[model samples]
Target: MSTPGKVSLEDKFGLFTDHWSPKIVGELNGQQVKLAKISGEFVWHAHEHEDELFLVTRGTLLMRFRDGEQRIGVGEFIIVPRGVEHQPVAETGEVWMLLFEPSSTVNTGTAGGERTVTELERL
Candidate 1:
């Protein structure tokens, strides 16, 4: 068994530089805590049974929805409710964020395609 310790978001964010790929850092109650670096635009999609929480750590995130979009800045977060179509964009530059969702939640949601990450990497 392993003992609990502290996780440094800055250090974990440094482990990888790839965009759109989320690395698992922790898990609790069937939920996963992930870290990801994002830039450019991501495919529009929706989770059928799970809500997603995106917490901006550095830079900003523009979340686009069918009707409008919400801008998320560092230390702030936004929750995309289940079944609500939305897209994540980092128009300014690279953005760092923490993701909170169900362990079974897929990054690409129901729009599965090339961007779908079937196997997740653990930090």
Candidate 2:
């Protein structure tokens, strides 16, 4: 068995420098909380049956949809419903974000390819 302790977002975010790849931080009730650093544009994809929540921790995140786009800034978050085609972009340098989704959620969603992360690293 393992002992449960408090988690610090700042300390966790400092663990990696990779872009787009998310690192798992915590889990609850079949859901997972992840941290990721992103820059530039990401693949346009949609979760067939999972809703994804993105909470900006640092910098700004641009969420592009078929109709329009939304800017998610620090302390702000956006929830993309299941099956909504969307893309995340960080044109203004690196951005830190927290993602809340189901444990089975894939980074690339339905558009599986090279960017798909089948396994995630736990922090």
Candidate 3:
């Protein structure tokens, strides 16, 4: 069994300094909770079977879809359904976000690139 305790978001965010790299913080059921600091643009991709949830904690995130775009600000979240191609961009500045997804989900999805993280580091 795992010990129970508090997981500080600020403390977790402080452990990493890379963009687009998500560090695992906690897990529940079959899902993993991750934190990432991102700026600039991410590649367009889609998970065939996993949906991804992104909650903005720091700056603004512009989520672009094939159809349109949605602006996610602090405390706001957006879930991208499986098989939907989308991209996230932080044009103004760095953005901190919490990601919730199945443990099997990959960061880059089908659009594998240099940013694809097959193995994630825990915070």
Model 1, position 76, has a per-residue lDDT of: 100
Quote the lDDT for 52 in model 1: 97
- What's the candidate order when arranged by decreasing lDDT? 1, 2, 3
TM-score, predicted candidate 1 vs. hidden true structure? 0.97
Q: Which candidate has the highest TM-score of all?
A: 1
List, in order, the clash count of every candidate structure: 0, 0, 0
Poorly placed runs, candidate 3 (over 4 Å): 1-3
TM-score, model 2 to reference? 0.96
Model 2 C-alpha lDDT per residue in residues 44-119, reported as the tens digit of each score: 9999999999999999999999999999999999999999999999988999999999999999998888989888
Scored by lDDT, model 3 comes in at 0.96
Off by over 4 Å in 2: 1-4
Ranking by TM-score: 1, 3, 2
In candidate 1, residue 41 scores what lDDT?
97
Error (Å) of candidate 3 at residue 74 is 0.4
Error of 2 at 69 (Å): 0.4
